[model samples]
Target chain A: DVKVTQSSRYLVKRTGEKVFLECVQDMDHENMFWYRQDPGLGLRLIYFSYDVKMKEKGDIPEGYSVSREKKERFSLILESASTNQTSMYLCASGQFKEQYFGPGTRLTVT
Target chain B: AQSVAQPEDQVNVAEGNPLTVKCTYSVSGNPYLFWYVQYPNRGLQFLLKYITGDNLVKGSYGFEAEFNKSQTSFHLKKPSALVSDSALYFCAVSPASGGSYIPTFGRGTSLIVHP
Candidate 1:
């Protein structure tokens, strides 16, 4: 079975703090994606990595960066967290058409 | 670019009754459409996909979707609704031939099953 695990299920950070959300997949899929899901907005892509060290900005990548140093792990970094950055972040990994998702991390910035 | 749309924000149905959640897409090439369901505070789970061959594809949890090329729609359906089926349903689309394999998701439709 394909397993995608996120580092944290819930996180709280103060404003102007740095935040990191980690995701790891056991399937070794070639693609990893980071998305923030909001009410009514659905899942908006923040960043995606096709291969190690290769990253592309999705629809909304502002204030966020991604790292893919290895095939199994993908990390999302917030330069400086703000209250507006609070969201439920999801990570997915897949190849071709099918993607598997992690449980998701709900980040709250105060 | 590929895009998907779920026309209705929410759909309400009674338990044991038939339910349908509408989804439409716009893509340049043949579309690889999918249906995913998200329970409260959980990630989305793949339900079904319409890649090729059969226009009607069955998936997990007794969910099925029909791919209508002419109408550019892939609506999700269930024979009998259940209270457990209440969740947020999202439709996604990806171009089969060219472009990236990353699928674009719709805003999603909230399904409510009343007893």
Candidate 2:
């Protein structure tokens, strides 16, 4: 089974603080994606990594960045957490078409 | 570019009755369609995929989807609905033959199973 694990299921941060969401996959998939889900808007991709150290910006990449130092781990960084950044973040990994997702992390910024 | 659409914002169905969630797509090449279900506050779960030959694809939790080539539609269907089956559903599509495999996802459709 392909297992994707997120560092946290829930998170809270103050405004202007930095936040990090971690995701690790056991299947060693070459592609990793980070997305923030909002009501009515669906899943909008924030970033995706095709390979180690290679990253591409998705549709909405305004205040977020990604790091892929290894094949199994991908991290999303919030430069300065804002209230608008509070949402459910999802991480997925896949080599081709079918991606495996982690539980997700609900982030709250106050 | 490939794109997916889930026209209905929400679907209402009674338990034990059949349910269908509509999905349409456009792709430059042969299409690879996928259906995913998302529980509240959780990431999406893979339900099924139509990669090639089979038009009717069965998936987890008794859910199935049919891929129609002429109409360019892939709709998720279930013979019986359970209250537990209520959730948000997303449809995605990617080009099957092209070099690009990145998928475009629909906004999503919320399914509500009435008791």
Candidate 3:
């Protein structure tokens, strides 16, 4: 079975603080993604990495950046967190047909 | 751009009854469709996917989805619903040919199974 693990299951940050969410996959998949899920917006892509040091902006990439220094790990960085940035963040890794997701990190900014 | 649409926001059904959650997709090339389920406060779980060959693909938890090329739809179905089956269902789509492999997800449908 494929396992995708996130660094944190829940987090709370104050406004204007920097935040990082990490994800690691054991399947050695080539593609990794970061998404923020909202009630009505579904899972909107924030950023994705196809290979090490290669990143692409998804539909909503503002105020967020990604790092893929290694194949097994992907990290999402928030430049400065705000209340609006609070959301359920999910990380996924896969090749083509199927993608496996992590448990997700619920971030709350106050 | 490729996208997926789940028409219903909520579907209510009695336990042991049949249930359907509608999903339609738009893509420039052939579509790779998928269904995912999310329990409360949990990440999404892959229910099934339609890649090629067969139009009807069966998945985990006694769920299945039919891929209709003409209608551009991939609706999810279950023979009999259970109280535990209630959750948020998402439909996703990606282009079979040229494009990013990342799948675009629908807004999601909440399934309610009443006893």
What tens-digit string does per-residue lDDT give for candidate 3 at B1-115? 8888898999999999999999999998898899999999999999999989999999999999999999999999999999999999999998888877789899999999999
Off by over 4 Å in 1: none
Q: What CA RMSD would candidate 2 show? A: 1.0
The lowest-lDDT stretch of 10 consecutive residues in candidate 3 chain B is B94-103
Query: Which sequence of candidate numbers ranks them by TM-score, best first?
Result: 1, 3, 2
lDDT of 1 by residue, A1-110 (tens): 89999999999999999899999999979899999999999999999999999999999999999999999999999999999999999999988788889999999999
Q: List A-chain TM-scores for all predictions.
A: 0.99, 0.98, 0.98
lDDT tens readout by residue for model 2, B45-72:
9999999987999999999999999999
Ranking by DockQ: 1, 3, 2
Of candidate 3 chain A, the 10-residue stretch with the lowest lDDT total is A94-103
lDDT of 2 by residue, A1-110 (tens): 88999999999999999899999999979999999999888889999999999999998999999999999999999999999999999999987688889999999999
Native-referenced Cα lDDT, model 3 = 0.95
Alpha-carbon deviation at B68 in model 3, angstroms: 1.1
lDDT of 1 by residue, B18-101 (tens): 999999999997999999999999998989898899899999999999999999999999999999999999999999997888
lDDT of 3 at A106: 100
lDDT of each: 0.95, 0.94, 0.95
